[model samples]
Target: MAKYKTLIFILEGSLLNEKVAEQNALRQTLKLTGREYGPTERIQYKSLQEKTKLLGFDERIKLTLQEFFKNDWISAKGAFDNQLQKQDQLNKDVLPFLDEVKNKVNLILLTKEKKDVASYRMQNTELINYFSAVYFKDDFACKFPNKKVLTTILQQQNLTPATCLVIGTNLVDEIQGAENANLDSLWLAPKKVKMPISPRPTLHLNKLSDLLFYLELS
Candidate 1:
């Protein structure tokens, strides 16, 4: 067994290289919809969520939409599920690297995905081999930044926070969740978002290419 019991990796969606992702999503969505909605006109994942409160859509459909963005789906049943494109290049970083390191890691994917939608997306992308487990909010009683959910994972995995590292793009939620769980944290700010000086990540990185180097893992 390695010194670390398991290397639990959490990937934040939207994009690792966020700008290209936004552009790609907008371009693809517009092309698919055949509507000239400017990229800026589309609301963000959070905003579209709030939109459900006003516009009347079926509750089930709205819930699916909310889950769709985080999971990075093109569409469900050929209907546009989300106007978001995952950065194609981010996958390039993982496939080659994960293939090499997977034996040394017990990979688990934690995301805000609802239901098993992300699992479906991962299968479509053929990326399911990269993870041992795929967890979504519906499986747990709570969501991120809520210690109860982290506690659930900890208990289920028989893991201590000291032996784990939480990796993600968002600082306030992801990193803070790790901190609250007493785990080491990695903030992947590939877009160069300004991280505050206080409560900084144990490791801060600009690219997934630099991940192995920063972690000092084989």
Candidate 2:
């Protein structure tokens, strides 16, 4: 057994680098409805990215086009779900890396991905059996910082927060979330990101498997 009993992973770029579920959802929704209000320029998208209120793909869709496209929301939302089903690329490293600790640790997958979309990704990537639990964006009342989701898991699983680790590819806000929940954090920043970084990670990794080296197995 490893020293830690639980490991919570943020799935976006950590478990899988592809965010096709997000971008594709937006693209597919746009294509289905012929809405061109979506910012095409990188600057515009980047500007919107910083707006926390418009952070969610579904929220962005509903709010931005709510006026003219109000009637077709169900279909537009369906398009988002449809594209998620076809999302390509699973981090090939995920299964092998997870295999190292699955038996000794309570493997939990946490994501901003909604429940259905997350399930679709897990099933399609053959990752359904690897996780003991999965957390969706809609699963919690609020996002990480405002919600101690990790702590919630710790209590539910009868685990200790000090013995848990939250791993993420982008820790800008997630580190704070983990800390607020009283859990340690491990981050993988392959390269420099243009955005300002905050709440430093407890550990940094060059590769996913490197996480195993830090774990104390018994």
Candidate 3:
């Protein structure tokens, strides 16, 4: 039998190359404003985004754009959104990994993205067919790292925390959320970054394909 009855995946960085998408979006936004940004600016922008993550998506985008541009921030935000949609792509390992375990456990996508954006990205990547269900930010009515969202998902899916595994790339959101909910979590750290002592995930993987070995052993 499979170790977990359900595998809840974080859609953005887990399945999709969100870093690439975000970088591309930022580049497009800069182009729209006729501005040039280097690694330093990108790092600062990312830090700012992290600090403002609690805000709604639109608000966060607006605030981030305002920090860099004096005017036409709305147009920059629109350009970023449009470019993000076009730039979002599935990780190379996503297809092969999912194919190996899709039949073993129920696949659920839990995303902080709004329904429309999440749906568009999933459909664009041809990932919509693989997941049994998708829970959008709209469904939860709150940002991530909230235990309530996980508990709500468990109740709706008729699952216990022990029977489910949360997989995500973001430590603060996905791993911490699972920890708060008392669920097992697998951290997909592509760069093999050292995990912190607090809010540690149950498992740490260097790549998405490693999950197949874990599932087999479990």
Cα RMSDs of all predictions?
A: 7.7, 5.1, 3.8
Question: What's the TM-score of every candidate structure?
Answer: 0.66, 0.68, 0.81
lDDT of each: 0.57, 0.67, 0.79
By descending TM-score, how would the candidates be arranged?
3, 2, 1
Off by over 4 Å in 2: 19-85, 191-197
Top-lDDT structure, candidate number: 3
Candidate structures ordered by lDDT, highest first: 3, 2, 1
Q: Which candidate leads the pack in TM-score?
A: 3
Q: For residues 1-218, could you state the per-residue lDDT of candidate 1 as single tens digits?
A: 21454555664342233334444554565566564545444555445544442222234234533454435333531344353323333444666667766767677778665645555445445456767776676887877666676667878877776767677766556667777777777776644555667457777776555656544455
Let me know the TM-score candidate 2 reaches against the reference structure: 0.68
lDDT per residue as tens, model 2, 5-115: 778888776776545445565566676666653555335544544553213334554653443346776666667667656675666678888777778878888887787
> Residue by residue across 170-208, what tens digits does model 3's lDDT show?
777778889999999998874546776867998888888
What would the TM-score be for candidate 1 when compared with the true structure?
A: 0.66
